[model samples]
Target: MILIVVGVIMIVTSLVSTVTTNYKKLQLQPTTESPGRDDWHHFSTGSYKLFPTEVNYEAAKNGCRNANARLVTEGIRNKVTRKSIMDEMILPAFNANKLGEGYGVWIGLDDLEVINKWKWIDGIASTNDNTAWAPSEPNNGSERCGMLHKLLKWLINDEYCLVANAYVCEIAKSK
Candidate 1:
């Protein structure tokens, strides 16, 4: 009976020690990660921040690439999502610049690769359900680029890729 108790005690003690060791190891693991910049901001929809500086489409894309991000691409789809992105991301910048209704901002979408076949730079699939084109937009023009046309109530429209315009850059927040 004493032997059985001793064996049971030994087993329990072994389990306790193992559990304690594992707990300590887990505690030593890093719990918090930092992205290193406080100026970066995000909206509640999927947590991505926009760079408000204006530039032409190519230059803006290059700028975003330099910053380890890409031009804004994730939010504009249906009218609701488009409005959300415009209100949350583009409108604030426009308000800050005191820009007029005719102004536009370059987005990460373009049909440059194939006419009328728009694609986001982030590789998000383009579908009828995921499009927010203004009526008569993607209008088969030589522009071959997409922008959030403020005059059209912040809807997506094709514009000249080389046109100098304010752009939004999207940086995904690290988990």
Candidate 2:
């Protein structure tokens, strides 16, 4: 009797795990089938249209800084900007890479060097405080890089800073 109960519990647990993972992966709408031209691969940061390069979090941030810019952070919760990101940033990267290609991109926010405190490379915190994951995000589990997960909605991760992947760089607008 005990053995049978244990087996049934295990089966149920496995099924639940599988269901949750699948649900997360299905959150995003599908990416574009045909990747357009290079110019169409990215979105605008203020007045400057920025492009992404394959690199880790730290390097990408540094690279952007060298050019007096910063990494792209999707802290915007507006409809227009969201649509552009869906069309430009997300779709292009999906088509150009693997299913979850380009896991590491320097966004405008991270708590790698710090903990719980996430700010953009530009030193500005997200004005929209609602752009957070489901309560207990950032896992902070030895992970030091941040990426917008393919599924899991606003779920973000922190992995090693040196881990290279595709990243979005942001340049400041001329006032």
Candidate 3:
């Protein structure tokens, strides 16, 4: 019986080895991930502070999610911090041709189903306008896209999922 058991063990070992080899032979190489579906941004204090680019809202949100960050917004009351984010991330997000007194960066800013109750992609809720949006902004009904108004105010202007200009991305510090 011991001999039979030993023979079985040897057979199992051989089988496992054969299977492993075949698996190795069929191993697939790692493929590059697809780019964002929407515009996205990435901001890190230690890493690059600002990374802004054009993308769809969903893709932009996903990019932030992949970085383990929620979307940032004006609901955050600190004017200085929000301004820094705008200067570093939003202002420089686009090239010289893109940057202007008129055109602005689309941030994680938005007003959801709740009217005038602004929200950020980071899940912040605020009725206060701290981030800047241009005057007469946020005129669209149920529009959710947010852009820097002037410099510090967040303006609700575009549709929630509309494709727009560049965007600003922010990464929250891990608590």
Candidate 4:
């Protein structure tokens, strides 16, 4: 009886150990699946998806939100990263004529709350020196939203919020 009980206990211990190890491995796997779109590209900061279809600022925001992301913002702060996006994502879409008739791609910056005071969608203030604004940009007080202007070598430009333009969305890196 003693021998049988010891054997049963050892088997139970092994099974429990195996189960715990497998559970831990499963837990370490990524939780969020990629959005339905196929063009998601990973960067150091997060994954970005380009939406070449033309849409107004608000509609663009909604589209990104639907994909469990927000419009591209903080990630573009780094010049190298910005160039990577321009080279790998924006340029391809633009060259293929996928970005509609517009000459700009909507980003997440806007001055809706206060004219000339640009703020990202996340409510973070952006400075002129830190951003890649074009010469005489944010010039029109009537234009409250930000975009990457094709005519300006993809430099940032303030545009009318209601204007239809392509957009980029970002899924922040998991914390």
Candidate 5:
């Protein structure tokens, strides 16, 4: 009888664990589709445009300027906006470049002007708490440009400024 009880308890524990794991998984999963559209993708919670084309940091800045936007940065200050950009723009761009295209995309964060002091192209100062960086990243002293790492859940990393990569553009909501 004791052995039977132990077996029953084990079954119960296994069932509970499975249920908990599934629940957690559902909570973590994000919607595969993006939120809104403005000829360019837009997240209703945040106003910004995503340009998935490949370009170096300087060219990207110029492109955004031409389009009346800036490279994505200000709108990504919070988790919701950041996740939207990742799922809607960054992920798709990364997937499309699977054929030996590029490593990552620019996101306006860089420490080129000063060591360890990352700032967005728009002059917004970046703080460690405000952004996500891949493990042991920003390690290369010479590669002072910042990018959204495709394999690392869109985490930020520093890379060579000269290397061309896809970039995201941010258009502020017109008041």
Candidate 6:
């Protein structure tokens, strides 16, 4: 009986140590399913990070690339996803007055290559039926880059690519 009790305690101790070590490894590994960084927020679609500093559209794209992510483009497919991004990542910064003078964030949609032919960075064409655009938006042909207009209730609007704005980065889930 004494030998059995000793063996049981040893086995329990080994299991506890293994579990603790595995937990530490999991915590160290960067995961898209959870927010590993303070600025990142994980949603069902992916992990998003808001960069509150103002920068030109190109700069914003580069920043995201530097972080092993991309400017939020394909992740925002419809109203539901857009709303989730706004409520989860963008709104908190806007509510806190953390955004730049533009009061918006740069997304990956742009008509830089072809006028009025909006496409995401991944080369996916934006559908006209998408209702995320603000009223009378994408009006200025010269303003080809896309951004979420905070004053317009987080609706999308075209802006000049040269204009500086806060931007959101996303680590998309693997299909």
Could you say which candidate leads in TM-score? 4
Q: Report how far residue 142 has shifted in candidate 4, in Å.
A: 0.7
lDDT of 2 by residue, 19-122 (tens): 99998888765766434323433334342223456676777777766655566654233345545665566556566763244553445566655766666555
* Of 3 and 5, the candidate ranking higher by TM-score: 5
Candidate 5 residues 1-175, lDDT tens each? Answer: 9999999999999999999999999989996554444567666544566565667888888887787678777656667778887777666655676313667778778887888788877787887787678888878888888887767666788888888787777765631
| Overall lDDT per candidate, in order of appearance | 0.71, 0.55, 0.54, 0.86, 0.75, 0.83
Reference-based TM-score of each model: 0.67, 0.56, 0.53, 0.79, 0.69, 0.75
Candidate 4, TM-score vs. the true structure? Answer: 0.79
In model 5, which regions exceed 4 Å deviation?
1-37, 44-46, 96-100
The predicted structure with the larger lDDT, 4 or 6, is: 4
In the predicted model 1, the residue pairs found to clash are none
- What does candidate 6 score in Cα RMSD to the true structure? 7.0
Error of 6 at 140 (Å): 0.7
Q: Is candidate 2 or candidate 3 better by lDDT?
A: 2
lDDT of 2 at 149: 57
TM-score of 2: 0.56
Consecutive 10-residue window with the lowest summed lDDT within model 2? 40-49
lDDT computed for candidate 1 = 0.71
Question: Candidate 4 lDDT, tens digit per residue, 20-130?
Answer: 999999999986675454668888878888888999999999998998899988767667668778989999888888888997789889999988888988777898656
Prediction 6 TM-score vs. true: 0.75
Best-to-worst order by TM-score is 4, 6, 5, 1, 2, 3
What residue pairs are clashing in model 6? none
lDDT of 3 by residue, 1-175 (tens): 9999999999999999999998887776454453442343333332222334556566766665676554555323356666566565555544344544343555676666576666665565644455444566666776676755444344445554566445544544542
Measured over all alpha carbons after superposition, the RMSD of each candidate to the real structure, in angstroms, is 6.1, 21.3, 6.7, 3.3, 17.3, 7.0
Locate the minimum summed-lDDT window of 10 residues in model 6: 30-39
Largest lDDT belongs to which candidate?
Answer: 4
The alpha-carbon deviation from the true structure for residue 134 of candidate 5, after best TM-score superposition, in angstroms, is 0.7
Q: Residue by residue across 63-86, what tens digits does model 6's lDDT show? A: 999888999975676556677888
